[model samples]
Target: MYTYSDFDRAFINARNAQFRAQVERRIDGSLTEDEFRPLRLMNGLYLQLHAYMLRVAIPYGTLSSDQMRGLAFIAEKFDKGYGHFTTRQNIQYNWPKLKDVPDILDELAKVQLHAIQTSGNTIRNVTADHFAGASADELEDPRPYAELIRQWSTDHPEFQFLGRKFKIAVSGSPTDRAVTKAHDIGLRMVKNDAGDVGFEVIVGGGLGRTPMEGKVIREFLPKGDLLPYLESVVAVYNLLGRRDNKYKARIKITVHENGLDKYRELVEAEFPHRRAAFNGIDQELLDQIRPQFKSPYFTTAPKAEFEKAYAKDPVFRSFVDTNTATHRNDDYAIVTISIKKHGATPGDATAEQMRVMADLAEEFGHNELRISHEQNVVLPHVHKAHLPAIFARLQQADLATANVGLASDIIACPGMDYCALATARSIPVAQELAERFDALKLEHEVGELKIKISGCINACGHHHVGHIGILGLDRAGVENYQVTLGGDGSENFAIGERAGPGFSYAEIVPAIERVIKAYLEEREDDAETFIETYRRVGMAPFKAALYPDADKGRKHAA
Candidate 1:
């Protein structure tokens, strides 16, 4: 994990002090709610439906044990007893009191964390693959570049306020776990024909009312040119993107209005200026950032104990099969601890659980913890020999659910529960779905399904790319849930297709069950996942299942 330098600490303290005064003025009636909105938003504070929410950025989803402990302390002392880990790999304190926010910021500053650029129209937290340095499949760790981008973008004078909020994600692996296609700027590291690794830069991808996969603006961008090229892209968008209408303000919409060729031309034209302005400072910063992300000292260990535990305990076996991913070191395994136990909120972690995770990371995970975009905590460098002990510790903490890629492991946003903009509830729907699937005991059978839920069309929950996407809306004063099928968020990214009419809240679970049952019956074999079946058979079967009486009504009318 990257530690803050003296310069970084000084900057954060100064920012915190400024915000503290701003918060005080708001409380003292010098700044009214309307007057203080933008100021608070700039610091990642939001006035939610009921109370204030503070979103703390976790850059590239990396954290140390001390940082994790700090978050746990914040959850315990300041806000409610829990914090929600978001799809962007940030943590949100939903019930934070406005008066206590400055104190919380101070506390976060002590741990070298902040809420800077977590909101507003400027670039948000620069995210990367959660398994960046640990994953065996990646070309190189993406976090150094991510950190470089973060340092460059934080409070950048030109980009402090854009037409709309922008998100950027980087993934070094061939497999795209970072949802690169659904970001404003998505960088996937790829090897050129010359066998040199660079970036496949995808721009204009976004999900909301209007969802579109990013277009490949550059097939291979030289690693050295990354910062300037990114600046050029953002500069072009800032100048040309719509400011008249907030709906069409995003870069994605800008790209849509203007052809990709024209946008690319503009970006290319701006690139030389940006390149000259940078003058190699970005590369120097990157060189400094690289050492901070070097691989931890790995130990050669016998896997006999891990094998014994797997063989002897079915529960442990299930956990190992589901929760662990292959690490670069053969002796190490990347362990994803499921915070989504049956009936729990998808991403809410209690203070105690946070502490437990921190302890585990400190003890067994090389003092590093990663927050996955899927809203789970990962011990990215856990040795296989420690599996049994780690599993035992997790079991004690009630954090040992073995459903990493299963149906129950859902991704849901804090919808109507906390968000003022939400039209309906997301957490309840997610809870119901997880509980229902767990009770049925069919998740393992269902296998590798992603069910994302959002309260509205903003797609904060990434419903557009879920295998079974659920969008909850208020339909003429009633809660109606819409479903989309065959969506994928991987390297072969595609937006899901809608499956006809929305279902009532009461009708949703059964409707989803029908879809699952239909899949089980129609799939060619057990090995064929829901997505594969959907792709092969199309929406006809799932549609038939969701709206069983549609054909009956049609026939009767005829």
Candidate 2:
């Protein structure tokens, strides 16, 4: 984990003081809601359905054990007993009081965490692969670069008020666990034929009303030129990006309207000018930042104990099988703590549970914790021998769910319940689906199914990438839900296809059941998972089961 320097400490302290005064003004009626809106948003405070929600940034999804404990403290002291981890790897407290937010931020600043850039049209938190430094397939750790980008974009003069919120994700591994292609900007770390590191820059990718896979703006940009190159891209977008309509304000729209070739030409023309202006300053800064992220030391311990635990404890074995990943080091493993317990709210962790995780990270694992893009927390470096003890501790805290890549592990957004932009509820739907599947114990039987839910067309829940995706919509003042199938979240990502007609809130769960049952019946064997079966058989059978009346209507229309 990266520690905050004196500079970071001073900056956060000053910002907190400013926000404290602003909050006092708002409470005293010196500032009305209209006047306080931007100020509150800049501080990552939002007025939600019932209360204010505070989103705190976990930079590149990485945190220290002490920071985790601080978050736990905030959750317990101020809001409800639990917090919701978002898809962007930030955590949101749904019930924060308007007046207490500054105090909460003050506590967060003590641990080098803050809510800056967690919301608004400014550059949002820069995300990277959760298993960045530890992943066996990684060419380099992407966090230092992500942190560099964060520093450059935070309160940037040129990009403070972009047309819309901008999201950027970086992945060092070829597997693309960060869902880079689904972001506004995706940077894939690559090694050239000469073995020099660089980035394959992809732009225009986003998921909202208009979902798009990013276009490759530059096939290969040397690592040294990354900052300058990124600056040029943003500058081009800032100058040319649509501002006339909110719907057309994103850079994706700019790329779509002007065409990729023309957009590339414009960006290329601007690059040289920006490159000359920076004059290798960004590279020098990166060189300085790189050493701060050097790999942690590992002990040469024997794995015989881990092997014995795997053989003896079925529960521990299951967790080890599903939740742990290979580390770059021999005796260490990356342990994923599953937030998706069956019948529990996906990504919701109680304060006590957070403390337990923090303790475990500090004790058995390195003091480093990671938040996955799937909204799960990870202990990035746990020795294999500590598996049994760690599992026991996590079980005590109710954090020992064995479903990692399974059906019950759904990714959902805080929909109508917490988000003002939402047209319908998403979290409840995800909960219902989890409960229904757990009752049937069909998760393991169905195998590796991803079900993502979004409240509206914004697709924050990533409904576009699920193997079985559900979208909540509003129809005639009633909440309705739609289903999409065969979506993938991998390197070979594809947006799902819609099943004919939408269903009411009550009908949606059964619709999902129908789709799953149909898959089990039509699949070649148990070996074929839902996604594979859906891909091989297409959406015909699932659609037929979901919308038989629609099929009949189509026939009648013909």
Candidate 3:
């Protein structure tokens, strides 16, 4: 974990003070809802369906044990007893009072966390691979670069108000765990033939009503020139991106309308000028920032104990099998604490659970925690020898659910339950589906399936990339959910295909089960995962299972 510098501390304190005054003005009736909207949004406060939701940024998804403890305190003190972790690697409090938000921001500032760019049409939180520092396949940790970008983009004069919210993701590993293709800007760390580090820059990618896979703007940009190149890309989009219509305001629309070649030409033309302006500042800053992220000292611990624990304890064995990832260090493992427990609210972590995680991170891990895009908490650098003890602690906290990358590990947004923009419920749907799968014990058989649910077309849940995507919609005063299949959130990312017509709230869970059952029956073997089966067999069988009558009618019509 990178400690916040004095400069960082001062900046957050100042911002919190400013927001505090704004909150006072709003309460005092000097500011109407229209006048207060931007101010509140800038502070990461949203007036959602039932109450105000406060989204706190966990920069690059990194958190210290102290920070985690602070969040637990906030969750306990204000709003509900639990918090929802979002796909953007941020956390949301569902029932924050309007007046208490500034106070909350003040408290967050104490822990070097704030919610400034968590919302609004400005550049949002810069996300990176959750396992950046720990992943075995990583060329370099992406968090330093992400932190550099975060500093540059925060309250940036040029980019404070974009046409729409801009999102950027970076991945240090060959495997794209960060879902780079679905971001406004995606940077993948790559090494050249000469073994020099650089970024593979991709632009114009996004999801919403119009989902687009980002196109490679630059195949190889030297690590030193990252900021300048990124500056050029965002500058080009800022100038050329649509302002006339909000729907057509995204950079993806700019790329789509102008064509990739022309867009590339414009960006390339702007690059030299932008590069000169930055004048090695990015490299200089990165040189300074790199030291802050020095690898934690580790003892040459034996892995025999870990193997013994795995052999002896079934729960520990399952935890190691499902939750742990290979670390760059031979004796260490990256353990993900699944927040998506069966029948619980997706991404909701209780205050006590957060404290337990903090304690675990401090004791067994390297005092480091990461929040994943899949809504899981990660202890990034845990010694393999500590696996049993850590698993025991997590199990007691109800955090040891061995369903990482499985069907039960659902990604869901705060739909009508919390989000004012949502027309239907998302959390309940995700919860029910998880419970259904657990009851049937079908998750293990399903094998590495992503089931993302969004309240609406905004795609906050990243439903577009799920193996079995569910979109909740409001139709005629009823909550209806539409299913999509064949989607993947991986290195080989593909948007899901719609299975059939929407299902009613009462029918959606059964419909999902039917689709899964169809996949099981139609699959070549149990070895084939849901995605593999969907890819091989396509959506026809799943579609038929969900809407047999509709398929038959279409056949009759044909």
Candidate 4:
């Protein structure tokens, strides 16, 4: 909830004017596509299959109602009527025209939003736990540190161009909902033996062509040493990371090539000089910014009405049970407004829906919003007393899906439909799977299952961490799908194991159905979800279920 300082406002305004000029130059044929590519990418514009896509940063996934309304206005006035929320907690307009993007940035800057560093080989948007301050079990709010890092990283001259793009995520809760382990830099706030708060710094974790969990570079780093240590890590990576091969340019590759100990030693060697260079300016800024995150006023609203509604309304109960999370205050709850309606695109939210969320944030929530990496909009601080009415309002807007963390709550990237890198379709596969699970009425029965689908190996859909991951590929110029099992994205982070041969897009849905049926029949009890069952009895059973004809082929060979 930090408003822009005068310097911040001036800086963004100046950048926007420069970009507008660059856009004009490109449009006038003074610059070719090759020349304008880097220029547009720096401003978070991409040429997709049919049109230009604009990705706007939602720093740490935090937004005010006014900011949310700005996004709504952009969706309404500029591109299509809806926008796609991405895994990086950013929003993308898929059908934006190249000519209109600069205007969109101008509008965004009016609300303290921008598209800078959303693309390109620079430090990308800083992300944190959606429930950073409000989570009931969090050690401390991690957004202050995240904000500090954002201010330091954005437009830092030294890191403007690196071997590869870098991402940083912070998690305040023990549950690790932010998928910190899958980031270039992951910071988890923890209390030490003496109860002093600090960070557990992790480095070299990402999911792409090569998937690896981040390794702990430092067991405990005092809060004061955060920026200096981070600088050292990035500096080492910048020096040692590969640039010859674009595929291996990520810091994860750098960490993999150099052993963790060696990397730590290099970082330690540079830490002293970097630490001294800090000069406490970042800390001074952090001290000034921390006050902006004060908790909203809480009223002792009676919960009797919520209890009665939970008892009386099954639909409302279903929504509250599925979408609500425990809050720091007993009377407040964190509500996840799922954008994945059954059989719809996973992350697309209409302008009307965005406006509705803004209205709810203003009236019921603390006038703040968070976009979850799972592509859901979160009202992080809503009073329990307002649950029924909010649910009713959301229902009226077609925003009450009541399917958070369920089979129907799928995470998918825009595959062949929009992305040029995609080989197969992700949205259709996600749609089919979600619809199949809904038709079976087995999503809630399955219990706490995550299904992530990616169009390609880039892993934008986080298919690597899903309980049931479906990856689309182009095999022999045909669209084939691959499945992975037992992947997890929480505290127990693990890359999924592949099952077997790729299935046709048409066959993938039924294959997934077989896998689910196997889980339902083979699980010890309803207490065990798909992941638990897969862990207990490896991938053999699921593989067998997926390829039932394998037994006949073996029999014929015998």
Candidate 5:
């Protein structure tokens, strides 16, 4: 994790002080609601349907145990007992008294955390692979680069007021766990012909009312040129991006309206000026940041206890099999604590749960914790010998669900339960789905499935890339859900195709059940995942399953 320097701390303190005065002005009636809207938004405060929501940035999703404790404190003291972890690797408190927000910001600043750049049209919190440094397959740690981007983008004069919000994701691993394809700018670390590591710069990919996968503007950009190139790209977008319409103002739309070739040409034209402006200052700063992310001292202790538990304890074995991931160090494993337990809110962790996670991270994870884009907490470096003890602690805290990539482990936003923009309730739908799947006992049999739910067309839940995407909408004063099949958020990213008509809220769960059953029937074998089956047979079979009576109705009409 990149520790905030003296200068960084000073900047945050000043910003917090400034926002504190602004909050007072609004409360005292000196500033009207209309006047306070922008001011509040700049500080990551939003006036939701019921109450104020504060989004705190977890830069590159990294957190220390102390920081986690701070979040727990905030959840307990200011808002409700729980905090909602978002798909962007950030946390949002859905219920905060407007008067208490300034206090919350002050509390966050104590732990070196802040809500800056979490909202507004400015570049949002820079996200990266959750298993950045610990992943065995990654060529390098992406967090260092992510930190550099964070330092550069925070309150950058030019980008602070873009036409629309922009998101950037960095992935050092070839596997693309970061979902780089769906970001405003996706930086995938790659090797050039000369065998030097660089980035495959992808631009204009986003999911909302208009979802589109990013296109590769640069096949390979040198490592040193990252800042300048990114500057050029954003600069180009700032100049050409639409402003008249808020809906079509994102860089994705700008790139879509203007051809990729033309965009590339403009970016290329701007690159030289950006390059000259940097003058190697970025590279010098990167060198300083690199050492902070060096691998933690790993233990080479024997895994006899872990082996014994894996063999003797079926429950522990199941948890291990379901939740643990391979780490770069052979002696260690990356443990993803599933915040999404069956029948619960998808990405919510109670204050107590947060504290437990913090304690576990301090004890077994070298005091380093991560918030994954999938809305889960990650212990990126847990020794294999400590797995049993860690699992025991998690079990005590009700965090041991043993479902990581399984069907019951769904990614859902706070939906209508909290979000003002939500048309229908995403929490209830997600909860019902998880409970339904758990009762059927088919999660293990079903295997890896990405089921994402969004409350509206905003795509905050990232439904477009889910293996089975459920998008909730308002239809004739009733809640309805539209299902999209074959959407994926990996390196081979694809937008899911909608399957026929929407399902009423009452019928949506059963409708999803039908789709899964169809997959089981059509799959070549058990090893073939839902995505594989969908790819092999296409949506015709799933569509048939979803709307069984449609064919008969068509025939009768004919």
Candidate 6:
């Protein structure tokens, strides 16, 4: 974790003090709703349906144990008793009083955390693969570069306000856990033929009304040129991206209308100027930042006990299989503490649960934790021999759900429940789906499926890339869900295709059940995942399952 420098601490302290004054002024009637809207948004405060929501930034999803405890305290004292972890690896407190926001921010700053640049049409939180430094397949640790980008983009004078909000994700491994293809800027760390480390830069990818996978703008950019190249790209988008229509204001839209070649040409044209402008200052800073992310001194633990537990306890084995990933260290594993427990809200964590995670991190997890994009907490460097102890703690705290990539491990946005832009309820649908699958004992059987739900087309839930995607829509005063098949968010990224007409809230879960049942029957083997089966057989069988009556009627009509 990067410790705050004197300059970093000073800037944040001053900024929070300024926001505190602004909050007081707003509460005292010196600013109207219109006057306060942008100011509040800039400070990461949103006036949603019920109350003001505070979105705190967790850069690259990395957190120290102390920071985790700070979040727990904030959840307990400042706002609601729980906080919502978002797909962007940020945390949101949904019921904070407007007057209490400044106090909340002050507390966050105490632990080197703040909510700056979390909203208001600037570069949002720079995210990376949660397993960045720990994964076995990584070419390089991506978080150092992510931290470099964070420092450079913070209050960037040129990009303070763009055509619209922008997102960037960095991945260190060949497998794209960061959903790199679904970001405005995706940086995949790679090595060229010369074995020199650089990035495979992808631009124009995003998921909203017009979902798009990014185009590869640069195959391999030398590490020295990364900041400058990124500058050129964003600078080009800032110049030519649409401002007339908010809906068409994204960089994806810019790339969409002008074509990939033209966009690439424009970016390429600006690189020389950008390189001259950067002039190695950013590289010097990156060198300084790299040492801060050195790995912890790992100690080997005996695996005999782990093997004994694995062989004896089916429950522990299931948890290990579902929630753990391969680590660079043979003795260690990357453990995902599932926040999606059965029928509960996907990312909601009570303050007590937060403290439990914090204590566990400090005690056994190298004093480090990561917030995964899938609304779960990660113990990235847990020793295999310590798995049973960690599992016991998680079980005691209701955190041991053991469904990481299964159907029940669904990702859902705060829908109409908390977000003002939502057209229908999303939480209920996700809960019902998970509960129904768990009751049938079908989730474990139907393994490794990504089911994402978004309340509206803004695609906050990442529904555009789910294996089984569900989008909630408002149809004639009813809550209707439209399903999409064959979508994925990994390296093989693809947007889902709509199966058929929208299903009502009551009918959606059962419809999903039918689709999964069809997948089981239609798959070539049990090992073939839903996305694989969908791609192999096409959408006819799944569509037939979802709309047996509609398909029968259509066949008769034809």
Which segments of model 2 are wrong by more than 4 Å?
Answer: 548-558
Q: Write the per-residue lDDT of candidate 6 for residues 185-295, one digit (tens) a residue.
A: 999988899998889999999999999999999999998898889989999999999999999999999999999999999889999999998888998999899999999
For candidate 5, write residues 1-558 as lDDT tens digits: 788899999999999999999999998999999999998899899988899999999999999999999999999999889999999999999999988999999999999999998999999999999999999999889899999999999999999899999999999988988899899999999998899999999999999999999999999999899999999999999999999999999999999999999999999999999999999999999999999998899878989999999999999999999998999888999999999899989999999999999999999999999999999999999999999999999999999998899998899988898888999889999999999999999999999999999999999999999999999999988998999999999998999999989999999999999999999999999999999999999999999889989977988999
Per-residue lDDT of 437-487 in model 2, one digit per residue for the tens? 988888778888889999999999999999988899999999989898988
Off by over 4 Å in 4: 555-558
Error of 6 at 158 (Å): 0.5
By TM-score, how accurate is candidate 4?
0.99
Q: Could you give the candidate ranking by lDDT, starting with the highest?
A: 1, 5, 6, 4, 3, 2
Q: Model 1 compared with the native: what TM-score?
A: 0.99
By the lDDT metric, which is better: model 1 or model 3?
1
Range of the 10 consecutive residues with the lowest summed lDDT in candidate 1: 546-555
True-structure Cα RMSD, model 1:
0.8
Candidate 5's displacement at residue 58, Å, is 0.1
Error of 5 at 358 (Å): 0.7
In model 5, the Cα lDDT at residue 219 comes to 92
- For candidate 2, give the lDDT of residue 416: 94
Worst 10 residues of 5 by lDDT: 411-420
Q: Residue 521 in model 3: shift from native, Å?
A: 1.8
Candidate 5 residue 472 Cα shift, in angstroms, is 0.6
| Clash count of each predicted structure | 0, 0, 0, 0, 0, 0
TM, every model: 0.99, 0.97, 0.97, 0.99, 0.99, 0.99
> Candidate 3 on 306-385: residue-level lDDT in tens?
89888888878877889989999888889999988899888899999999999999998878999999999999999888
Model 2 error, position 412 (Å):
0.8
Which has the higher TM-score value, candidate number 2 or candidate number 5? Answer: 5
- Which wins on lDDT, candidate 2 or candidate 4? 4
Model 4 lDDT tens row, 34-140: 99999999989999999999999999999999999999999999977999999999999998877887889999999999999999999999999998899999998
